[model samples]
Target chain A: MFGEELKQFQRLGFRHVLLQVLNFASVIASGLMIWKGLGLITNSESPIVVVLSGSMEPAFYRGDLLFLTNPASEKYKTGDITVYKIPGADIPIVHRVLETHDVVKKKSKRSKTALTGTGEQLLLTKGDNNEVDDIELYQGLDWLERKHIVGKVRGFLPYVGYVTIAMNDFPQLKYALLGGLGLLALVQRE
Target chain B: MHNIFSRVNNVSALFSSCMMGLLVAIALSTLLFTADPKGNLNIASVKVFPMKNRRVSARKQDLAFVNFNITADLRPLFNWNTKQLFLYLEAEYANGQGAKNEVVIWDRIVRRKEDAVINVIGKNKYMFRELSSTFKNVPPAHYALKYNVMPHVGALTYGEAGRTLEAVPFPESRERVS
Candidate 1:
């Protein structure tokens, strides 16, 4: 029972509880800071991503952790794994680059995202396990531009991101986890 | 006091810390296996033809078909941590817009060291078309045989195995196959 915990909490008084709350807040703040710092260093919106689907099999399975980086000056090449989000699609896709076409332009305004070696790049992608190219997944678009791409997959970790997936699938687990952590933080002494 | 709650927490923390350390070690180990194996890549022929789009037959497109030969020894690339090797033949070219392009025409996945020996004659396996649907006015294209090393639990690495001695030019588009 929490009788002993309550007695300890009462003995600690409200100031100690406030101190504990402040400590918890700092812990969360530091976590967010580290995430944002990694984003800045990698030049990606989300430097770490969890594989949500099994489209890319044998290489990346669902629940795997993927590290990504989007170098602004670099151009995508064939066989490079990329995570991209179309305008209307809510979830991003991870696929290997299948084709890249450097289009010739007569006169064009400079785009904010300048790809390497000049001109705009038109890329086509496909999943390693899929039979066809990713043209159908582009949502009526012919090619995937640099803007639609999130980042290129660089490092990988297996099955670690499954915790987040489990939390997402079962709402009760998420609440139970949060509640347990909060109770522990509040009840713990020092 | 190592109560059930504290025991669970401590055990999980140690387990995860050990896992992180192992992952870091595996990631760093790939740095030690630096294999730069070279080979020969020859483009025997390049044939361009005006074709209908696979999806929309009404639209006309230019498709380049290439026949190539590759000879390399990639057994040196397969180390203890190596999971598989993804070998690809890519065509690199630039359009008038000065944009550089790389397209993989053929690819093979080598999962075993015995298959790492690179000696093959192959042709394009996927469609090879430009964004403009034509290769006309496109500069000469260079073909290179590249390989990507995937590890069991580490960073992915890339390297060039072989390249055509001279950039191959995209031949004029033919009306129909003879």
Candidate 2:
């Protein structure tokens, strides 16, 4: 049988518990809705990113939050910083453009591979501080095209994402911190 | 009055102890083995053509090109002794029909500073570039570039702590004004 404490609390105010649960559900649903909305509006799988490393130093530091947007109608250009995903890689990278060539137009009609469609293009990228372009990292990929790009870095907030960086660096700390915060939120009068 | 005063002091002590415990937990976590940001600097260029910005009004017979010019500033971050850097390039198409149509345009060792250009041609193309072993043979409708840079031996900041790598994209020029 349930304890008297549980029954008494339930009888005294089940409405408060219901209201809190509803509030939590509403917050989560709203967050998901916003994410989906961003995906649709930007036409990108990820419309936001956190700068994980100092690879883009000065412009973006570690823990900086970046806002991304990749409109289906917009085209990427040289000097533009973009976030793209590799076929098998889980994480995406942000880098600048290096080179590009329209290969579809290069193959002859009689060639083994001939393009009959339109809007064909390829591109290269490199980091701002490294010595060479990112050819080795491509894992035999020659160039990145429109489909691989996740988004483009449009804006960023510095140091605001330190908490995210900390969480990523120490996953246990993240859970502990969350649990502690929840307890505090529950116990606090205000 | 005495009972009320004692109760208030007890509450205050409880609150202060909770605060202290939280602070200690945070401090302990910071000192624990955390995943620090490694100095493994990786730089590469991925093809970005037919993007929203690339506007080409060329016929099937005309010459269409996607030029990618990438540059990197590896001053303090590059460790000459420890890191062995590798580079690669590839091409793909967006439509699933272009499975048999793919190419590895370039792959090489990056011992010096230079620019790499990888071009893909097809009526429809998508490209990608990566730096890990996972992106070896990608599916259709995508292109990619891959590269690996070794960390230089010895402790040397090619520059500052937060400022190490910088990539510069070559200016897009009109080579084939068809």
TM-score of chain A of 1: 0.91
Give the poorly placed runs of model 2, Cα more than 4 Å off. A1-12, A104-118, A181-190, B1-178
lDDT of 2: 0.50
lDDT of 1 by residue, A7-76 (tens): 8889999999998898888988999999999999999999999999998887788999999999998978
Each prediction's whole-model lDDT (CA): 0.88, 0.50
Candidate 1: lDDT of A14? Answer: 97
Backbone clashes (count) for model 2 = 89
User: Which docking category, incorrect, acceptable, medium or high, applies to candidate 1?
Assistant: medium
iRMSD, model 2, in Å: 12.8
- Predicted candidate 1 versus true structure: per-residue lDDT over B57-101, tens digit per residue: 478899999998899999999998888888888998877666778
For candidate 2, the per-residue lDDT at B20 reads 62
lDDT by residue (tens digit), candidate 2, B1-178: 4579569979999997997686445434432322212222222333222222222212211222333333333332223232333443334332223323333334444454332222222221223322211222333233344443322211111111111144323123223333
Clash pairs (backbone) in predicted model 1: A104-B97, A105-B97
TM-score of chain A of each: 0.91, 0.81
lDDT of 2 at B6: 63
Q: lDDT at A113 for candidate 2?
A: 50
